[model samples]
Target: MYSPVQPMHIPDGFLSTLVSIVFWVISIVVLGYALKRVGKDLGERQMPLMGVLAAAIFAGQMLNFSVAGGTSGHLLGATLATILLGPWAAMIVMTSVASIQALIFQDGGLLALGANLFNMAVIGVMVSYFTYTSVQKLARGKAWGIFTGGALAAWTSIVIASLAAALQLALSGTSPANIAVPAMGGIHMIIGLGEGLITFGALAFLYATRRDLFHVGEAAPKGSKAIWVGGLAIAALLAVLSPLASTHPDGLEWVAGQKGFLEAARAPLYNLVPNYVFPGISNGSLATIVAGIIGVVLVFAVALGVAYLRRGRKRSK
Candidate 1:
C-alpha cells in the first residue's frame, strides 16, 4: 500500500485530551495575536508573496527524504518562511499548510492539529525569526552572515520543534521524557541539517537573482510577475515530483513503532484526499501528483485569502 508523505507530527491518540486542549488554547491565543500583528503591517504586494510561499511550503512538505535507521523526514519550512515573510506572516502561512494537510490530505490527525500548529507554526517560526535576527545583528548584516544566520535559524527551528513534540508526547504519557527527547532530538538533528542546507541554498539563490524579494514590500520591486510565476512553477514542479519521495516511515511514526505506541494512532475522522491519493484515480502515482497539485492551489488560495482579510482589516482601522 502506498502511504502519503507524513511529517514528524503527533497523530491522534499520541496525546492526551488535556495536553491537546492546552496546546489548542495556546495555539489559538498565539495565532490571534499573529493576525492582529500581521494586519497592522501587511502590504499590497505581500498577498502574492504569501500565496506563493504557502504553496511552496505545502508542496515542499510532500517530499520526504530518507534518513538513518530507515526513517524519513521532510522540510518543515518554518525557518524559510519566517525569514522570507516575518514571524507573524510566516505563522499564518505555516498554519495554512498544516491545516490543509490535516483537513484535506489526512496526513495528520485532526485532533492533533493544534499541537502540530503550535510546535511547527508558532514556536518554530518565532524561534527562526529571533535566531536569524540575532545572528544577523551579531554578524552586522554581511552577506555570508545573513546566509549563515538563515542556515542556523533553520536548523535550530527543527530541533526545537522536535523537542517540543517530544515533550508533548511525554506529557501525554505516550513516552517518557528522557527517551522521547533524545530520540526525537537526535533524529531531527540530522534532519535539521538538510533543512539548513536547503534554507541556505534558497537564500543564496534569491541573493543571486531577485534579491529584491527579500525586502519586497519595502520598495516596489520590478519583475514582480516573473517572481510570482517562478515561485508557483517551482511549487508545481515539487508537487509533480512528490510521488518519488521516500516510502520509509517518518520520524514520529518510526518512534511510535519503536516505542510500541504505533497501534495507538486512530483513523482520521473523515477523508477528503486520504493519504494524498485522490479518489477514483487508478494510478497511485498520478493520484498523488494530482492531489499535490490541488494542495498547492488550495494553500495558495488560503494564504491569499488570509492576506486579503488582514489587509482589509488594516484599511478599516
Candidate 2:
C-alpha cells in the first residue's frame, strides 16, 4: 500500500524549483492564517484534539491497503479532519502532518514540501470540505447522510489531488500530460474507492461513539470502550498490518514509472531519517512498524505544540 519511504508524496526533483517555491509561499500563507483563526473562535478546549486527531491520521496512513492492479494508496484523512474539526483546523492539521513527514521522516522532499502540502493538505481539505457540506445539506436526517458525505468527499479529494499532481508534473516537464494524466487518473480512481470506504466507515464509527466531538466547541468526548478499541486497533495496525501491507509502490510512484519519469525523483538534501528508518533498524518489517509508530508520536507532538501556542495566543488576546 505504501512504499514506506514515498507513498503519494512528491519527491524533490519531481517538481521544478520555481513551482515548488511558489507552492511554498502559498502554503505558508494559508497555514499562517489558519493558525491565527482556525480554533481561536472556538476557544482553547479544542486545541489538544488537534494533536489527537493528527495522531489518528498518521496511524491510519500507515495501514494502507491494496486497491487493484498491483496498486495501492493510503488515507489523506482530510475529510475526516474537516468533519470533526472544520475546514480551517483540518487544513492546519494536514499541513502540520505533511511538514513533519517531510522533515523528520523524509516521507516527502524538503524542496517539494510546498507542493506536497498544496496537493494533500490545501486542495484535499478544500475539495473534501466543500463536497461534504454540500452533501450534508442535501442528505439531511438520513442515517447515511454523514457517511455518504464523508465517502464522496474522501473520494473526490483523492481524484482531485491526483489530477493536480499530474498537471504539476507535466508543467515541470517530468511527464507528458497524455501519459501521466491517464495513468494517474485511472489508478487513483481505484485508490479513491479504498479512501472513500475507509473514510465513510470512520465517520460512522465516530458519529456512533463520539458524536459529541462532531462540533468544534463541544466538550471533548469522554474516552469510552469504543475509544479504547479504536486506539488499540490503530496500534495493532502499526505493529502488525503495516508490516504486512502490500510492498508495491503506491499510485503516484506507479504513475511515475509508467510515464517514464520515475528517475526524475531525487533524494532530499539531508535525508534525515531516510525512508522513515531510525538509523540502524536493519529489519525491513521492523523498521516499517517502528518508523510508523515514531512518525505518529512525532506528529502528535507537533500538533500539540501548535495547539498550545494557539491557545496561549487566545488566552493573552
Per-model TM-score on C-alpha atoms: 0.65, 0.65
Which ten contiguous residues of candidate 2 have the minimum total lDDT? 240-249
Per-residue lDDT over 246-287 for candidate 1, one digit per residue giving the tens place of the 0 to 100 score: 122244344444543333343343353465464468577887
Model 2's number of clashes is 0
lDDT of 2 by residue, 116-142 (tens): 897788777777766676676687646
Candidate 2 TM-score over all chains jointly: 0.65
Q: Model 2: runs farther than 4 Å from truth?
A: 1-7, 65-73, 216-317
Q: After superposition, how far is residue 182 of candidate 1 from its true place, in Å?
A: 0.4
- List runs of model 1 lying over 4 Å from the truth: 1-7, 63-74, 216-317
Give the C-alpha lDDT of model 1: 0.72
Worst lDDT 10-window in candidate 1: 240-249
